[model samples]
Target chain A: MVEVEMNGTTPSVRDELITEIELSFGLLHKAAANFDNRYISRVFRDLGPLRRKLAKNGDALATVIDRLYPHNSASRAYLLEVTGKTDESMDEETKSAVKPEVDLYIHLLVQVYLLDNNRLEELNKFNDKVIYLLGSYNRRSLDFIQAKIWFYISRTKELIDDLHSIRPALLSALRSATLRHDTETAASTITLLLRNYLLCHEVNQAMNLVEKTEFPENAGSSLVARYYYYLARINAIQLDYSSANEYVIAATRKAPQTQLAVGFLQAATKLSIIIELLMGDIPELQLFRKQSDSLEPYFMLTKAVRLGDLKLFEEVLKKYEQAFKKDDNFTLVSRLRQNVIKTGIRIISLSYSKISLKDICIKLLLDSEELAEYIVAKAIRDGVIEASINHEHGYMKSKELLDVYSTKLPQDDFDQRIKFCLSLHNDSVKSMRYPSADNRSDINKHNLAAKEDEMDLLKAIEEGDLDDFMD
Target chain B: MSLQKLTAELYQLYDQEEYEKCQKILTPIKLELIKHNLLLPTVANSDSKDKINDLKIAERILEIGALSSLLSNNYRGFENYVAQLRPFYSNKQIHAKPEKNTDQTKIISLYLLYLLSQGLVSKFHVELELIYNSKQYNVEQDQYLLFPVNLEKHLMEGNYIKIWKVLKNDTNLPCKEYGHFLDTLVNALRFEIAKSLEQTYETIPISNCKGLLYFPQEQSDATFESIIKDDLKMTGWTFKDGSITFKNDDDSHKGNVNPNSINLISNVLSYAERIESIV
Candidate 1:
């Protein structure tokens, strides 16, 4: 470590990290004294660059601790011990008092450093101490820091493939967060627990938790988006495709529109495509084109379903079987086999008003006419297509198309969209958070300062709050 | 009786094939378990080996409750038991490792079959997603699990012939309990086929129709017609000249006015009024 730092190239990078840490420490002190979270938010705005630096030179964590803690403080000793580095040349003028916010922030940095370095076992061993410290603090300003720290903790546990043991700690944290009205921590814990449950395929428990708990209305948008994503996943597995479609749509909408969130967008969009296919609706081609990442598997899948080609669907499933399984959409995609045949039958009925069973077999690549007859019959029964079979003649005749103007299909479609828009508006109004410092007397100054603060939080969210989508 | 003594007796009764007596004793035993805090494994009580064993016994009792209800023709009770057993199955303490051909897999598979037989394919798929992904249960290789999984596949593909073979061949059944659902499942399969055949054919030779519905070759046409009409409610069929012809009943309802047009008109008028005010 000393030899690496002695090099001219690395010393400048190390010095830059120390300067940033000192700046962050000043921000933390101001936030702790004024009880203003915006300062902490300011500190997090520069977290992306700081995080990269620390992950490379985690030894800087030792420097931050020594600078922020008095020599005899337990936090300094514990943090230095965790970092496994000691500073013997600390001067008397360098020591500062430790705040819980600073303590937790330093721990958060260590977590990110360990994670990026692939030192999961050390991180795992280090979690108990951090959790104990977190339990001792009851400050509201620590809520955001607590929330982010728990995310890293759960991430470490998940990486170690030990998902169950963290449930007790997370559930207790959720209870305390809610009791203290710590919306950020409560929201983060709920999402972590839901992710844990879904990871183990415990849909029943996840559903019960969702039914029991009321997610804080004023939770951060990223956490809310993740909660919705998990809900969509659970509902999709439970075969509620319509509700699942709505949730996935909400998830994609709520997700941050930044380069950092492209992974989440692709995942949410992939799920949206599958649910749409299951609902017997073809997702627009633009849906696939929206993702910068190659959603080649889903694109191919939608094409196969659109063309009503069962063989192509099979080939795609076979080819991307591992990818689908990795995304945990394998079972849902496997369920599309029936949808493929239904679409095939639908297309055949549309193209030929009256078609023989044998021609249907050949077109569908069916083994025998008997198979095609049964499939078309099932499709009709499932309301996938409007056609009747002539059993003795072994031919199917498409029912005459209903008058589009007279039928209620168009009306129902319009009604659903209108209702959706109304509900979305109602939900937004319900969850709107009023600023506590709303003062009409000095409107101009307050508005300007509020806009700046809002932008800072938004910027911080864009830069450092892709934590929920890390999974 | 002590809870242990009662549990012992229940086990004996289960072994002796006395499901009724076992069910009667099960009610008090569950209450006893609730009294002892061993009903559902929790973090506090499930810490020790003894409590875990007790919970395992509780799980076993619920399994018996589920199986006994099905065997005794109390389907609603069976469903309730399956619901009660879910937490126990999901508890990490009890199902730490995968077990093969145990009563748990059979009970879960039975519930899957129940869902399929009830025509709740959506619910079946939901349950299937959980089972297939859970590390504790191997859906593909397990004997009891594969039956329902394979049944759903063939049913979705509309290969009723494969489903017929699955049902007809008793060897395909993993346990005797599955035999109870055979009649109902066959009836459901026949109903599905009958609906399809009616829509697919104007007239079908009686013998071919009989074969499609899985009727015995020697059964009289009168008997087949009575079963088809009464059971499947295929009233649109008429038998003549060695063939059966379908009467399309949907023709009468065609061209009917939309039932909700008045509501639609009222909504449109309200919208117009609101637009006028805005203007």
Candidate 2:
């Protein structure tokens, strides 16, 4: 038997084939630029002609393979089978069932497949081919195509630049795209730009753009809600609590009851808790926290204290400790940690005479003796703890430290209120007098002064003072 | 396991003069790492690759180029990449844009600078800086590798060198096409600031720093009392104040949402425009 091996394809032939493929790709790209649904449907219809022409070709698959990968001498076997031209004949039934150009269709299908499967390696190769083909265009045409790509990719910075590159032309294209019910382009372009604006901390530009954009009539509920949700986030980041809350409410109403929207709502609620805390509105903070898993317990604890409900405080604190371990990083979450340390001290010192201030300090692991003393002094000044010279009952007891530190650190309008707390404590207590006093009167005075020294050393209270300098 | 560990291994390969080994390890994961959009500081740089020849490291350095584009917050290199991917991902209506060489250079350079400054590059920043600042390194005369550092240094200086040096270097530098424009920008600013500061130095009082820092012409309801009593109640919220004051409308300034967000946006836009003037 004579063996007849096929010759390998030439480089020039491969180049010619690649050039034709590129021309086809360029035409497809131009068609997509219209973004007209009717036009797109018509184009799909027009492709039927090519499909018919491909069907008439006896060896369509092999012909296409030769055109696409002629240099790959390894694909001969696969090619023959694909094209129904194999000399090792298949059964008539199997041959009839196989379709021409199946491989061509599969190659096209692979683009979507690789993207869906996160097979970026294949996708990147495809990208390189397209870039090589399109990279030779003029400047204006280049900008338009690049803009569309960036818009679809949700790569915001490039999207913004591409949008601005030829503002009049880009904007006109976007407007026409929207008119044609290309909601995907409209939503993706606007959302990506908004996200970039937010990332760069450019809230106003984002807000301005967002507020000006009207939702398309047939816009997906999810898309509408997402847009509003991001707008709300910008508001929240800016500390516009009311506006943030309002935008979230609007989003909830606009969005369908889907998991994505629900997730957005949860994020919005977290923002609300932070805003409420800043506003000195503990009750509202708890109310908002109920919607978010992360902030709920912390807010509930604060709510219990603000309402002066001891039972509620103990119940929530117990659950909180179970949920948040003492060593957990979240236990030290700034806002909640502030509430826990201050409120725990305030309630125990003022209301519960049985637990010593020192006992409360131990509960909180506030072993720093300096902190204990300052907290005690702050409580007395706030009138939460009475400043009495009597050592046995009300005088410098360890159990009472918890009550003294419980109040919300007042800010802005309440700044002077904290200062007032500090000054009052300062006036009532005697300064520590040292250098070895032997006389009984001197020793008593020294003890009084030593109590005052603890107040000066407390870190949290000093933090409250330092707050003045910060803003 | 962790990027820190991977980066450390990469560093080890780098240090052992195993450039190909390091490249093999990194090349597969580079796209995935870049896709995460991690900030440069979080990317660990190992010292291992330093033992290899610089040219060997250069091959692996392209991964940094790809990564910088991927991780750019501004998506600087993304357009080029996306343009390539157009046929695969794009519908019939969309096409890849032909990228301008100059535009590509600026973006690629900017992305690299951002990456290098944030410590994301495979080699240490000091090495890049050394390569950048070398007197023998003339960007126009050299290649793309040398161009980025020169552009950055020239940008920082925003100045013109002596005429002979300028004439010699001009043909090599990309900025020469714009006519040594950065010098004009720097000179103009220098002249303006000098003229104003000179006047202010003799006449203006430096006593009121707070007033100088703030908008002196505008009146604010934020009196010291309101600031102290209403705003600064130190319970972990002063940071919130800066954000809030911009949006607060009720008691702070009822019926009016502060346009502070707009101010910030406008300021950034102006700064970007100012930077554009040099390039």
Best by lDDT: 1
Residue B170 alpha-carbon offset, candidate 2, angstroms: 52
What is the per-residue lDDT of model 1 for residues B1-279, given as tens digits with 9 covering 90 to 100?
A: 499899899889988989888889989999998999877778998899988888888888889889988998899999999999988998878898895788889999999999999998878877888887777888778999988988988888798878888799988889999999999899999988888777666678999889878899899999988998898887879998879988865654453436477868876776566456446
lDDT tens digits by residue: candidate 1, A1-471: 532543433667777888888878787888889787767767876776678767667676776676677877776766777665775655678555677788888888888877877889988988988899899999999888899899999999999999999999999999999999999999999999999998887787799999999999878788888999999998998889999998999998998887777788888988999999999999998877766356888899999999889889999999998888888899999989888888988888998999999999899888888778788888887788888877767888998887777766678677767667666766866775455654444445667875776677656755556644653
Q: Is the docking of candidate 1 incorrect, acceptable, medium or high quality?
A: acceptable
Quote the lDDT for A166 in model 1.
98
Q: What TM-score does each of the candidates earn?
A: 0.84, 0.29
Model 2 chain B: lowest-lDDT 10 consecutive positions: B86-95
lDDT string, candidate 2, B1-279, tens digits: 555466667767655656546546665455545554321211132223442222223323443333334443324444444333322221111113422343333434444444444434322232332223333233344444445455333322212232214334557555422332334333333332222222221122222211222223343435532432353232211223322111111243321233345644765575566446435
Candidate 2 per-residue lDDT over residues A400-443, each given as its tens digit: 23232232222223545544555555544434233344445654
Per-prediction DockQ = 0.45, 0.02
